[model samples]
Target: MTIDSFTKLYERAVDLQRLMSPFITGHLVVEFLLRKLIQIYDVSLTQHADDLKHARLISLNHNISTITDAQKDALVGINKIRNKFAHRITHEPTLADLKTLFIKCKDAFSDFTDGIEQGLSEIDGAASVDQLEEWEIHELFIQIAYDLHHVYHNRGGDIEEF
Candidate 1:
C-alpha cells in the first residue's frame, strides 16, 4: 500500500480513538478501507463516483471470495447498525442489537475477537459481550476493518486464484 493510504487510515483511526459512537466511527473507517479495495478493481470509480453509499460500496466487494462468509456478514451487520443509528435521534444501541451483530462476530471469528476482548478487558473489563460497553462495540468495528484491510492488501495472491 502507498504511504498516503496508510496516512489516511491512521488519521481516521485516530479520529475513532476519540469517538462517542464506535459503531458509526468504525463504519467510517471500514468504509474507507472498502473504498480503497474497490479502487483496486475499478480505479475509474474513484474519478467518477467516489462517495458510494454503504450497501453499494459493500456490493462491490461481494465477489471477493477471499473474504470469509462471516466477514461478509459482519460488514452487512455493521452497515445495518450504522443505518439504525443514523435514522434515530439519541439512540443508544440496545444489548440485543449488539448481541445479534457484534456478538455474532465473536462467535464467527473467535481468533481476532479474542484479541479484541483481551485488550478491551484490560481497559474496561469488557471481556465478553454480556457486559459490552459502547467502546467495546467500537473495538469490534476496528477488528472487522483490519480484517478487510488484510484481505485488501493481500489480494494479489487471491487475484490469480480467481
Candidate 2:
C-alpha cells in the first residue's frame, strides 16, 4: 500500500479503537439483554446455550432465534456505527450522537460480555472474556466475523459454517 493508504488505514484504525470501547460494550450489553429476555420470557435457545460458536452465529445472523427484534435493530445500528466511525464513511453523525452511541455501545458490550462470560464460566477450563486483559481476543474475532459477514452478504452468499 502507498504511504497515503497506510496513513489513512492508521487513522481509521485509531478511530475504530476509540469507537470500539463502546461498540464492543454495546455488543456485550446486547448479550445480557438477550439473556434477560430468556429469563423473563423463558425463551430457551438450546442452540445458543453455552456455545461460543452459536453465540457468534446468533450475533451475525439476522434470523437468529435467540435475538429479539430490538437486539436485531441494535445490530443493524452497530453496522452503521462501525461504518461511520471506522471507515469515516459519513460526515453527518453529530458529536452528540457519536457520544451517545459510544456510551450505549459500551453498555451493550458490557452486558453481552457479561452474559458470555457467565455462560462460558459454566464450561470447565474456559477462561474469562474480559476487556481489560483480553480485549484483542474478543475484538479480533468479532471484527473478522463482521467483516466476513459483510463481504459474504454483499456477494449474495451465506456465511459459511465450519
Candidate 3:
C-alpha cells in the first residue's frame, strides 16, 4: 500500500473514529469500525462521474446492481436528516425524527461498512494499492465525512477537517 492511499484510509478512519466519539461518551456502545470501511468506499468511487448525487442516483436507482439499493437509499436519507440537523435554525428535531435518524444511521453504517469489507476482500485486498473510480470514492468519503461531522457537531466537538 502506498503512503498516499494509507494516509487516505488513515484520515478517514480517524474521522469516523471521531464521529463515533460522541456515542462512546454517552455510554452507548458504538461497536463498528466504520473508519476503515468509509476509506474503502472513498477509494472505490473514483471512476464514476463527478456528480456524487448522480452516483448516489445510480446506486439507488438500480435494483439489480451489486450494491444494495436500500443501503444507498438509507445513506441518502441519513444525509437529508443530517442536513436538517445542521441547517435548520429554528426547527428542533423531534424525538421521532431523532429515532428514525439513529436507525438510518446505524443501518447505513452497517450496509456501507459491510460493503467496504466485502469489496476490499473481493479486490484481493488492493484497496490501498490504487484508487478506484472517482465518484464512488467521493461518495464514500462524503458520506463518512458527513457522518463524522454530524455526530461530533451535534455533541459540540470542534473538528476542523474531514
Models sorted by lDDT, best on top: 1, 2, 3
The digit string of per-residue lDDT tens for model 1 on 29-148 reads: 887777767666667776433676887777666764545567677678778767865775334455456556645575545446564555334334434333444556566776776676
After superposition, the stretches of candidate 3 with alpha carbons farther than 4 Å from their true spots are 1-48, 54-66, 105-162
Listing every candidate in turn, what is its Cα RMSD in Å to the true structure after a full C-alpha superposition? 10.0, 14.0, 18.9
lDDT per residue (tens digit) for residues 17-69 in model 3: 22223322221111121222223344354333233343343342233232344
Model with the higher lDDT, candidate 2 or 3 = 2
lDDT of 2 by residue, 1-162 (tens): 122576775775565424355555645644444443333333365345335432453453435444444545445555565556445432333444433443443333334334334323332232322222234325423543344344334444445531
Against the true structure, what is each candidate's TM-score? 0.65, 0.31, 0.31
Residue 39 of model 3: what lDDT? 30
| Candidate 1 overall lDDT versus native | 0.61
Give the best candidate by TM-score: 1
User: Order of candidates by TM-score, top first?
Assistant: 1, 3, 2
